[model samples]
Target chain A: MTNENNSLAEKKTPPIYPVKTKVQVSIIFFVILGIYLFSMFWTQKEMVGGFSGAFENMFTVMEKFFPPNFGVIGAIWGPLVETIQMAIIATTIAAILTVPLAVLAARNVTTFKPLYYTTRTVLNILRTIPDLVLAVIFVGLFGIGLFPGILALVVFSLGILAKLISETIEAVDMNPLEAMRASGGNVYQVIWYALVPQVLPQFTSLVLYVFEINIRASVVLGFVGAGGIGLILNQQLGFYNYPNAMMIIVLIFAVVIIIEYISTKLREALI
Target chain B: METYSLPPKPKNSLYKKLKMIIITLLVIALYVWTFVSIDIDWGRAIERAANNFQRVIPKLFSPDWTATGEVALSMLETVFIAFAGSLMAAILAVPLAFLAAHNMMGGKIFSTIGKWILSAVRAFPDLILAILFVVAVGPNAFAGVLAIAIGSTGMLGKMFSEIIESIDMEVVQAMEANGANKIQILFYAVMPQIIPEFLSFAIYRFEVDIRASSILGIVGAGGIGTMIIFASNNRNWNEMGTILLAIIIVVTIIDFASSRIRNKIV
Candidate 1:
């Protein structure tokens, strides 16, 4: 009995986590904590009154935006409609342009390794630049109008749509495509017959999703003089007409919510 | 040759046909309305592009090396703002997530309210939030931090609640069977299940916040965007080029690192 007990005691029990893993996890946790602390310190240094004071200031600032002037709604209607139109045009253009780019980028579809890689790289670079920056650049070139705003939204949405659609394409059933190829169909025929039917619903859903994003983006594009309700809002704010700015903000909120609701419903029906 | 009878053609439902036709017409009308309503000075745009294309395009390609230090410093501030804001949001979102998670909350009312609050927060773009906070906090880096924190909280809270809802309840049931209290069950079973995903999402939000914070400086909230605005105002395309390069490199690196870390965690 004593010998058996000794052997049992000598047996190694498995741990919930290995010692090495525990050490690594602890080190990582500490590193993250350290970074967070340093960041808090650095950012707080620039604040005049710190967090408490800022909170106090926020309440006072909030008071200025209350009782939004409904009087500006009639005046702002034209620009508001323009914003929606800009989003619609951009989304339509992007959806149309995304097909070729998405196909080229999808590894399973393109087959040619260099072409796939080149398209992928270009899309990746394009996605890194923010929509507003694109708008600013386009506005600089085009001299401030709805055209630049639409162009910016198109480029921005194109990058995102291409990436998403390519992923969807890559995940598709290749068997049908292979069967079409084996039946002596050309590349376009195979894609049209086999691939299109499979991806159409998802493609429509993603386009609606991108449209929702474009609506939100187009609203802000006006800040850079790219033409939209945002330009009016910026002007109102500059003129210290908080009531008008508040009204515009409220209208934007309403339009955004309504459009998103409609888009979401449409997307649900599609997918 | 014997004549074979052709099979009957498949007929679409009347409702489906009408729906398709109506949708098509609506789309066409929308396009027509858009084209007619939009006012574009095509001649001006064309002339401006022609002249600016030569000047701006070339300068944008050749970056100003002299502004490297300033850009790097601003970029670092951008990172710091993102980190601080994301951490704040990660912590702040926990209660909201719990409130929003139907499995965790006792009634539908609180969860619905929680969800509404989150969506409301999400509707405002980060730039607009930054603008508000700049006014509130006197136009500093702190405002950017506040904006990012609030903006990220909306998304993080929503994601975290979804994660909570999807968690396995068997562990909680087992803990309850062992006579564990609500708090005990939550700490022992619930926290262990959701912590990894929560951390992963928080880190991912940090990646997004970095991109967001980089541009907040345009409103004087503080980041590389201030330099961008100044550069553009000064028409210093070379400086703009350098700033753009810095943003791209930083954003890409952060995205890569965050994704790697998130993959490891989740």
Candidate 2:
């Protein structure tokens, strides 16, 4: 009986993690660690005094930004409004343009495989390009002004809005659409009667979300000479006017928080 | 045919009608203000496009193959900055995530403070942070890494906390009933549930960090953006073309690989 019990215990004992999984996890962990070590070494090579020196200088450097000049608030108000206007204009244009592109990209709505695939591919490629890069190019083309900034924002927001709205289109309940088709409705009539109502709330929510992103983006577009509060901020920093830069930064932070709060409330009410 | 008019359209309440009219009027006023206030030099823009369009568009297509090596090196630096930054953020966010997670924290106040800190950190764009770090660190790849690290931490912390909150608590309770200590319960019950998602989100953040770090160079924080600014200033469209190509290819590849890994991990 003792021998039989010993054999049963030996046979029943199992490892907490399968041997294969253990090996894989360890290997992955080590590989990631190795990559991280290499990256740190490479990046640190370019530093003048490395992390230690930077840490020592950080406090003193930060001190230069304090006692922010509230005087600039009056000066910056104009560009601040320009920044907000840029976002609003871009969001509006993008929202209107996204409808058709979204429909073409949605597989269930478009149904034509070639058209859907082409639109999807174009949008994917478009998204891969950073908004800053787009702004830079348009500034080159349009000679550094609000036009380039607005154009960049419009293009950037279009990619995101189309992708989001298309996904919402794809997930809609098909029963109503099918019923409309059965009632002898044409394609346009069916889409208008069945699809629009279902997607309107979500579309509005997504557009609001994109508008928040646009607001953040438009603030930075001025860095590349695209025109807005960022242009003034950049100039102040260039002049080594840390106090004014600090003021601008504070203003940007407050505006961003306020706008985001309002947009979030609107989206919550929407969806 | 029976002279039966369609059922009378339902009348909206007075409040609803007023609300609709107010919204419409506000929208129209907004557009009117925007168009009138925005100062656009359409004439200059049209003129510039006519002259520069031919010169720029052609060169953009025919990239300077000679600049590929320089562009590739800078692109590699951008990747390294992103990787190091994202990894640091992943580790740094752990304690904050636990602090913010309502279930993990002992007091609601701590969680609320944690949440506020995360959002505040998130409010500053990576570029803005890069500018500050560049001043402190004297404009190097390390500055880029620091900016990316801090910028990513806010997002990662929030996501990790959400993951923690969504975890099944019954297992933790069972561990407690079995006389397990806090540390034991965390390791044996909680970590197993959250680890996969944490790693997945960290990897995804790495992808975003790459794109972000690429532009940090604009402020001299280090990466491809420095090259871009130089190229644009000199009107070197061919070089800009190569840089653009490199960004698109690298971003696309990283996004693909990261998504695949995230799928497997989660």
Candidate 3:
């Protein structure tokens, strides 16, 4: 075995790619220097107003945000609850819609080139626009309310959920899909029996993941006068009601963290 | 006699049932909490629906044509913010990722700390991070850029570490066996394998950052989102429409360019 290995090694030399040390170092130096210079130039010279001004203002800002009013939390409770419901409803709708969309988009499942490409392109375009932008547009059309928020969530989550679920679908055990097809099952039956079972865990996980993102995004949407906690938060900020804003921020942070923890645990189980 | 060999039904069925019930209740609680928080009035909502429809319909089909130039400039700012932010993230994440990788650091305490920091960073969404930075530094395009950088580092670090972890161990082993030092092993064995994936992910993140940067403007971080807010608030549907067009154009172009580049690299 040793003799054979030696002979093989001798017959076929391993490919070698030379590394140029000095050229690489110079390139790295130039890139770093360029970035530093660019950022320095871009930051407004007058706007920064040095460290002293920033330091003096910091105390004032902190003072305003102090003694967060817990009372406001209960008042905003209803809106906060609505925000989550919006996310839940939208996520559920998107998750259900994403099933057919994702299956159609998955290259392996769809088979036909044009249909696959078209579905993927649509998803890509959908994903290119941010959720906030979607909300802004929807709010313009629908007028500011929970409806706009929900519509935005549906579109936004559809983009992500579809892309993720399709990828999962593509990665599933193909042999089962083929076996079902071989057994004379129709397209729906094949997908149902084979692809659905294999990708269910990942699909559910992705849906939950999108839900988390949607919750956070909905808050931002609310800031733009679309109905939610963000709308109230924006109003407080506008009014310079820093204490109230601080309360909302704190509550949001706590809720976000808790939800993330639970979702993470659930995702682990699902996957 | 053969029945004795049959497998006993799974034990702890009661416990499983209890766990299921608990989970279902939690889901319900979560739903209830959200509903209560958002203050939805179904009756009022239904009443306002038609009025909303009347106000918004005219603006949908006919966008304002005049604000196209300003929209274009804002779009550029958005792209600039994303690019600059992602560039910073890519630069910063490289060393941090190397440090965070388990095998690279050889079970060092510093690596564990680095991993923890990255995870914490990843836990917060880019938008929330932007809000924090806007508060810290004052709201501006600069804050937006910094926010994207901070958020992107978390993701890029996570991906880079995973990439490093998945690299063929034999290559590094061979380099070590040949008396190559740590740096040599990194350059010669590790980087070549993961460079393509790293670049692709970075570009993908950049595309996402572009969209995010545009939205960050709504929070006073400078971008097209500011114009979007202005147009909407002023009830200038034409201006809003123009901005939307510009946004669509910019996004489509970037999306196409990035995908092409990613395909080439990966």
Which model scores highest in lDDT? 2
| Prediction RMSDs, each to the true structure | 4.0, 3.5, 6.2
Best of the two (1, 2) by lDDT: 2
Per-residue lDDT of model 3, residues B23-94, tens digit only: 899979976765556555557656666667667656755876666677887887777778788988988898
- Write down the TM-score of every candidate: 0.93, 0.94, 0.82
**DockQ-derived CAPRI band for the predicted complex in model 1:** medium
lDDT tens digits, residue span A170-190, model 3: 888889888889979998898
Residue B143 of model 1 has an lDDT of 86
lDDT, residue A126, candidate 3? 80
What are the per-residue Cα lDDT tens digits for candidate 1 across B161-219?
99999999999999999777899899889999999999999989998888889878877
**Clash-forming residue pairs, model 2:** none
lDDT of 1 by residue, A1-271 (tens): 8679757865765656789989998998799899988887887788898889988988988898878999889999999999999999999999999999998999987899999999999998888888888887888778888888999999999999999999999999989989989979998899788999999999999999999889988888888889999899889988978888889988998898888778879988788
User: Cα deviation of A7 in candidate 3 (Å)?
Assistant: 31
Error (Å) of candidate 1 at residue B109 is 1.9
Return whichever of 2 and 3 wins on lDDT.
Answer: 2
* RMSD over all Cα atoms, model 2: 3.5
User: Candidate 3's error at B241, in angstroms?
Assistant: 1.9
Q: For residue B205, what is the lDDT in candidate 2?
A: 97
